[model samples]
Target chain A: MMLPGFPDAAPLAGLGGGILIGLAAALMLLGAGRIAGVSGIASRALGISDSGMSKSSAWMFIIGLPLGAFIVAVWSGGLDAKFAGTGALIAAGLLVGIGTRLGSGCTSGHGVCGVSRLSQRSVVATVTFMAAGIATVAIMNAMGLEVLQ
Target chain B: MIARYLPPLLSGTLFGGGLALGGMTNPARVRGFLDIFGNWDPTLAFVMGGAVIVMAIAWRIQARLAHPLFAPKFALPTRTDLTPKLIGGSALFGIGWGVAGLCPGPAVAALVIEPASAATFVAAMIAGMGIVRLIEKD
Candidate 1:
């Protein structure tokens, strides 16, 4: 199952990592008064021009996320990317920015938060957005769009 | 005995393993997948599908709980409007995923292995959230 994306492994790790985050977010919401929404916290901080306490906590959440895998890597090891080039990374970032903007939430928000709550709307958003994501990758692949060497 | 936190832990580990197995854990793999119309890696759907299967389980179990582990009930978003924020953010997310193959959770998680750029991706993502939150004005 994992072999499919042999060349890259981060997203595979990411999927596993994302589940933890989602579960944590769900538990955070269920156990605490928080919403488990990163944007909400970041947005609030951005509002005050202050990444304040919440901002720090949010960072901790994001930062600590990899700590698990980091711990795993400490004992074992991990793979690395050669980079298709700078242009490619930049373009990819821009595309994600657009998706986050359009999706009203990131994968975490919609995929985790929205979907967890069993929101019908979130259901549509997740399906639609994810489908679009698939399509985007397909198109990019078909175009033979390569990172400028 | 104290198995309450077990579910999250187990689920999380499985999720991580899924990522590692699917290659979603790697940024470059994501880029290649998104290099659509070119590389057009369809492996992503499998990753998403597998994760969604877990997601479905989470949803089902959610109903069984008398009360969620944290909140009185599931904390679904109150905002229902398909405001520009919704559509626009999604579009931006799609484009970024298509181009860079970096998404929020994984990008942050990717920080562990590929320290440099993953950090940058996360920073921009955080900044984007901050900026949007500010302009929305409550």
Candidate 2:
């Protein structure tokens, strides 16, 4: 449950949640024969990209994301989250949108699905983004930028 | 119709639920995980580890199947080349992820938890995707 020296860590919950996510992705892959990459699917749903999947299916998946979270929130009392300022959210959203398009995936696609398959591109992308993320956090900490409160 | 729609809907719902249970929906937890140098939280590593482990098993199963259960063929990515676009885009994405502690999936999943903020991020993300579409069209 709790990690030593890291009082805030919830290892068990993390692992449980992760297994659920993996099962979800596995369902998509096995049942639908799709990768379940959110960005690409979202783009397809929004008509920004013309991938192999149908728009209706994409929309269903997108809708299910919030619906599933809502169910979990209801069952587990509620959910708690902290967000950055409006400016930061917008900036980050834009960067994520563009970057995922260019890179062809995100944490779900590259980190989980791609890495599991041992794809070199996904591995490289995962490491690169992780390094960038860690570096960004370090720089932000050094600057004393309180993005999350 | 059921085969076409049900799988994604179910998968997305499970994905969302998993994110919430795993603490991926919490920006503080995500940022804490990313903040390895300053008060690091290892919760995300467990999440990633578990997901990857399960998926690795799924991949082995995939190698044996000629086609997905409901679909005629697997629509997986085939390109293996490492490109500048991939590295640059991922780095930019990482910066954004670090800045806000939200990615595409979690941002959508959090729509119910934090409606206003999540909506704003999703809208901006769509706009960003649109911008890329415009540039690529040229």
Every candidate's DockQ is 0.30, 0.89
Compute the lDDT of residue A134 as modeled in candidate 1: 66
Task: Name the DockQ score for candidate 1.
Answer: 0.30
What does the lDDT read for residue B124 in candidate 1?
A: 61
Q: Please tell me which predicted candidate would have the highest TM-score against the true structure.
A: 2
Model 1 misses residue A74 by how many Å?
Answer: 3.8
Per-model TM-score of chain B: 0.75, 0.98
Give per-residue CA lDDT, model 1, range B20-114, as digits (tens): 44556565666666554454455565565445555556656665767766335554456666565566567666666655666765665566677
| CA lDDT of every candidate | 0.54, 0.92
User: What would the per-residue lDDT of candidate 2 be over residues A2-120, giving only the tens digit for each residue?
Assistant: 78898999999899999999999999898888897899899999999998588998999999999999999999999889988899899999999999998888999999999999999
Ten-residue region with minimum lDDT total, candidate 1 chain B: B1-10
- CA deviation > 4 Å runs, candidate 2: none
